[model samples]
Target: MPKLTIDGIEIEVEAGTSVLQACEALGIEVPRFCYHERLSVAGNCRMCLVDMERAPKPVASCCMPVGEGMVIRTDTERVRKARNGVMEFLLINHPLDCPICDQGGECDLQDQAVAYGKNTSRYDENKRAVKNKEFGPLIKTVMTRCIHCTRCIRFAEEIAGVPVLGATYRGENMEVGTYVEKTLDSELSGNLVDICPVGALTSKPYAFHARPWELRKFESIDAMDAVGSNIRVDVRGGQVMRVLPRLNEAVNEEWISDKTRHAVDGLMKRRLDKPYVRGADGKLKAASWDEAFAAIAKRVAGLDGSKIGAIAGNQADAESMLLLKELMQSLGVASIDCRQDGAKLDATTRAGYLFNTTIAGIEQADAVLLIGTNPRKEAAIINARLRKRWTMGGFPVGVIGPQIDLTYDHSYLGAGPQSLEALLKGEGEFAAKLKAAQRPMIIVGMGALTRADGAQVLAAARQLAEQVGAVAEGWNGFNVLHTAAARVGGLDLGLVPAAGGRDVAGILDGADKGEVEVVYLLGADEIDASRLGKAFVIYQGHHGDVGAHHADVILPGAAYTEKEGTYVNTEGRVQRGRKAAFAPGDAREDWAILRALSAHLAKTLPYDDLASVRRRLVEVNPAFAHVDDVAPSAWGAFGAAGAMDAAPFVTAIDNFYQTCAISRASATMAECTEAFVKGRQEEGKTGTHG
Candidate 1:
C-alpha cells in the first residue's frame, strides 16, 4: 500500500491506485475527461492536474500513480492555473451551441468549463472547423465540438473489440472518426455516445428530442436480450425519449447493446391500443374490452383441458407469465409452454438451465467452449466479458458451431453434435486443455437444445464438463446462454407443460390437425402462423405483429417499459423493472389484462393488483420474492434422461438485431440490421477474394 496526502488529508491506497482515484476516495473532487473507470488511462486531458510537494510542476492526476509519503494539493493556486489553462485550450475550438446541443444539460465539458475556464478566450485567430461525418443511424457527429478526449476511440478498441474508430491527422487537425466511411459494426457501439465528453457524439434518433433536465428518468431492466442489462428509461410527457445504461456490476457492467438502447422507437409504432375481434367477413374489427373478452370466453367455454393450449412470448415478464398460468389452470388448461422454440431444457433444477457460475465468473475462467451459439449476437455484453478475459491473456476459447467472427481468436472445431462427441471421447485437441484448466466453462446456446436431438447434445456437453472437472468445489461453469429475456423467468417458475400436456410443437401440430379447439398466445410471435389451421386464436400483447395477424381476437397489453414486472436473467438473478411510461389508449398492463379476462370467464383470479400478483409469483417460486438472488441448487445428470438421436444442432436466432416484435417494429433497428448484413456480406466477399 502507498500513503498519499491530498489537500492535507492523508490516506493509504493500494499499490496500483491512481492519484485521481485516491483523491476520489478521500472526498476530494478531481475533474477529468477521458478517464473512464473501465478504460485505460490516456492522461491526454490535463484537466485533473494536481500539485505535488516533491514534483517540480503539476501532474495529470489521472495517470500519476500514488507513491509512499507523497503529498498532493488539489486546491492550490498552481493546480488551479493549470486546470484553467487546460480548459481554455479545450474550449478554443469548441462550438458555442449550448442551446441547440442535445448534451447541453449533461455534458462533462460544459460543467468543467463553467468551473475552471476563463471568462473569455485570448486567441484572436479563426477557430478550427471540421465537417461532421455520418457514423450510422444511431449516432450523430459534430467534429468541430470535439475536445480530443479519445474516450470514444478507447471504448471502441478496448471495450467493443473493434478498431475502426481512430484519430486522423496531427496536433490541432486531429479528429475522431472512422478510417473510412464505414458504420460502427459492433453490437456494443452505442456506448460511444454515452462516453463522449462533449456534443460531438450524440444520439441520432434523439437529436433535439428533449433536454435531459426536462425528462423523467426511471430505473428499469432491458428486455432486448436474456442478459437483462439494467437501464434508465427517460420519458418526456408520457413518451419515452431515450434509453441509457445503468451501472450493474453483476450484469451489464455499465454498458448496454445498441438494440437495448434504440429499441424504444418500436414502442411508438404499430402499437395495439385497443382490442379487436375477427368478424364473419374475415377482418379484424375494433371492439370494446367487454366484447373481446366475451368473444374469447364463448369460444373457450366448453373446450376440454387437453385441447386448450397457451404460449408465452420471449419478451414477457414473470408476473404476466405467472398470471397467465394461473388463469389457464383455473380454466382447466394444462397444455401450456413458455418455450416457443421447443427447447429441451431440463427445468427440474436451476443449475441445469441457468448460467450457474454467473456473468462475472467469466473473468475467473481460464478455458471456455461455446456449443452451437454466438455470444456476440445473442448476448453482446457477455461477449465483451470474454473479450476482456482473452485480452488479459491465458484464456483459451473454443467454438463448436457455425464459424462466426466472435471478435476473438478461438479454435473452430467441427459444427454440430459430432464435434462435441469427439471432445467427450477425448479425441479432440482442446479436450486435454479443458481437463487441465483450473476453471472451465461450457456455454450451450438454445440453438443446440431446440433441435430434435437437443437432449443428446445437452447430455454430451454436461458429460464433457464432468469429465473435465468443470463443476467442482467453488467452481460451477456449466452455462446456458439464452436469447429470450423471459426464458429463465418462465423456467424458474416451472412454466413447462404438466403431465399429459402438449409442448409447443405438439400444440401447434394439434392445432394444425383441428384437434385443438382454442389457442392463447401471450405476446408470442416467433412461431409459424401457417400451421395454426382453423384454431380460434386469442392474442394478448402490445404489438401488432405476427401473433396478432393470426388471431381471431386481439387484446391490447402494456409493454415492458409501461408496466412494473419482474424478470430473471440467464444467471437466475431476479430483478424487477419499474414502470417508466403509461400504455397507449385502451391498453392495460399485461397482468391486468389477464386478470380481467379471467373475470370475464367467471373464473376470477385470486390477485387484484400487481402486488398480489407478485405475491402469488413468490408463493409459487420462492426465488421471486428475493429480488436479485439465485437460490442454491446442485447440478443434475442428463445422461440417462434421454437417448441420443442423430440430428445436427440448429440455432434459433437468425437475425440478432430484429428478434422480437418490439425490435421488428423499430426503424432504427431495421437500419442497423441492414448495415450489419451488408457488412457481413462484404466481409464474406473479402474472405473469398483473399
Candidate 2:
C-alpha cells in the first residue's frame, strides 16, 4: 500500500491507485471529463489538476499514481487556476446552448463548469463548428457539443467490441465518428449516450421529450430480455418518458441493451387498453370487462380439462404466470406450458433450466463452450461480459453454432450436434482446452433445445459438462442461456404440463385438430397463432400483437412497466419491477385480471391481493421466498436420454430488436431494424468495421 496525503488528510491506497481515486477515498471530489472508472485512464482533460509537494508543476491526478509520503493538495490556489484554464479552453468552442441542450441538467461538463470555471472568457475568437454525424436511429449525434473525452470511442472499442467510432483528425481539428458514413451496428450502442459527458451523444427517440428533473424516476427491472437488467423508469404525468440502466454489478453493471433503453416508446403504442370480444360477424369489437369475462365463461363452460390449454409469453411476469397456473389447475386444465418457443426444457431439475454459474461468474471462467447460442444477439450484456473477460487474456471461447462475430476471438467448432458430439468424444483441440481449464463453462441456448432432438442435445451437453469438470464443488459452470425473462420463473412455479398433459407443440397440435376447445394465451405472441384452428382463443395481454389479433376474447392486461410483477432472470435471480405508469386506459394488472376471471369460471382462486398471491408463490416454490436473491440449485441428475440428430443447430434470435410483442410494436425498434439489420443487408456491408 502507498501512503498519501490529500488536502491535509493522510490515507493509504493500493500501489496503482491514482491520486484522483485517493482524493475520492478521503471524501474529496476531483472533477475530470476524459476520466471514467470503467474506461482506460486518459489524462488529456486537465480538469483534475492538483498541486503536489516537491513537484515542478501541478499533476493530472487521474493519471498520477499514489506514492508513499506524497502530499497532494486539491484545494490549493494553483489547482483552482489550472481547472479554470482547462474549463476556459473547453468552453472556447463549446456552444452556449445549455438551455436547449438535452444534457443540460445531467451533464458533467455543465456541472463542473459552474463549480470550477470563471464567469468571463478572455479569448473571443471564432468558435469551431463541427457538423453532426449519423450514428443510427437510436443515437443522435452533435459533434459540436463533443468535448473529445473519447469515452464513446473507448466504449465502442472496449465494451461494445465494435471499433466503429474513433478520433479522425488531430488536435483542434479532431472529430469523433465513423471513418466511413455508416450506422452503428452494435446492439449496445445506446450506452454511448449514457457515457457521454456532454450533449454530443443523446438518444434520438428520447430527444427533447422531458428533462431529468421534470420526470419522476422509479427503480425497476427490464423484461426486454432475460438479463433482467436493473433499470430506472422516468415518467412525466401518465406516460413513461424513458428508461435508463441502474447500477447492479451482480447483473447489468450500469449498462442496458438498446432495446431495454429505447423500447419505452412501444409501451405507448399498439396498446390493448380495453377488452375486446369477437362478435357474430367474427370481428373483434370493444366490450366491457364483464362482457369479455362472460364470453370466456360461455365458451369454456362445459369444456373438458384435457381440452383446455394455456401458453405463457416471454415477457409474462412471475406473479401473473403463477395466478394463471393456479387458475388453470383449479379448473382442471392440465395442458399448460410456458415454453412458447416449444423448447424441450427439462424442468424436472432447477439446475437444468438455470444459468447455474450466474452472470457474474462469467468473469471467473477460464474456458467456455457455446452450444447453438449467440450471446451477442440473444443477450448483449452477457456478450459484453464475455468480451470483458476475453480482454483480460487467457480466456478462450469455443462456439458450436452459426458463424457469427461474438465481438471476441472464439474458436468456431463446426455448426451442428455432430460438433458437440465430437467434443464429447474428446476429438478436438477446444475440448482438450476445456478439460485442462480450472473452471470451464458450457452454455446451452434455446436454439439447441427447440428442435425435435433438443432433449437429446441437452443431455449430450450435460454429459460434456460432466466430462469437462464444469460442475465442480462450489463452481458449477453448466449454464442455460435463456432469452425469455419469464422462462425460469414459470419453470420455478411449475407452469409446465401436469401428469399426462401435453407440451406447447402438443397443445397447439390438439388445438389445430379441434381436440382442444379453449386456448388461453397470457401475453403469448411468439407462438404460431394460425395453428389455433377453431380453438376459442382468449388472449390476456397489453399489446394488440399476434395473440390479440387472433383472439376470440381479448382481456387487456398490464405491461411490465404498468404493474408490480416478479421475474426470474436466466441466472435464476428473482427481481421485481414496480409500476412506473398505469396501464393505458382500462387495462388492469395481469394477476388481478386472472383473479377476477376466476370468479367468472366459478373456480375462484384463494388469493385476493398481490401479497396473498406472493404467499401462494412461496408455497409453490420456496425460492420465491427470497426476493432479488439467487439460491443456487443443487447439482443433480438433469436432462433426458435420447438419440442425437445430424441437423445443423440454428440460432433463436435472427432479429435482435423485433423479438417480443413490445419490441415488435416499437417504432424506434423498427427504425433500428431498418437502419442496422435490414440496412446492413441492403448495403452489402455485413463485414466488420474499424
Which candidate should be chosen as best, given lDDT against the real structure? Answer: 2
lDDT of 2: 0.92
Candidate 1, which segments miss by more than 4 Å at Cα?
639-648, 682-690
List residue ranges in candidate 2 displaced over 4 A.
683-690
TM-score of each: 0.98, 0.99
Tens digit per residue, CA lDDT, model 2, 11-64: 989999999999888889999999999899878888999999999999999999
Question: Which pairs in model 1 have colliding backbones?
Answer: none
Going through the candidates in the order shown, the clash numbers are: 0, 1
C-alpha lDDT (0 to 100) for residue 234 of candidate 1: 95
Strongest candidate by TM-score: 2
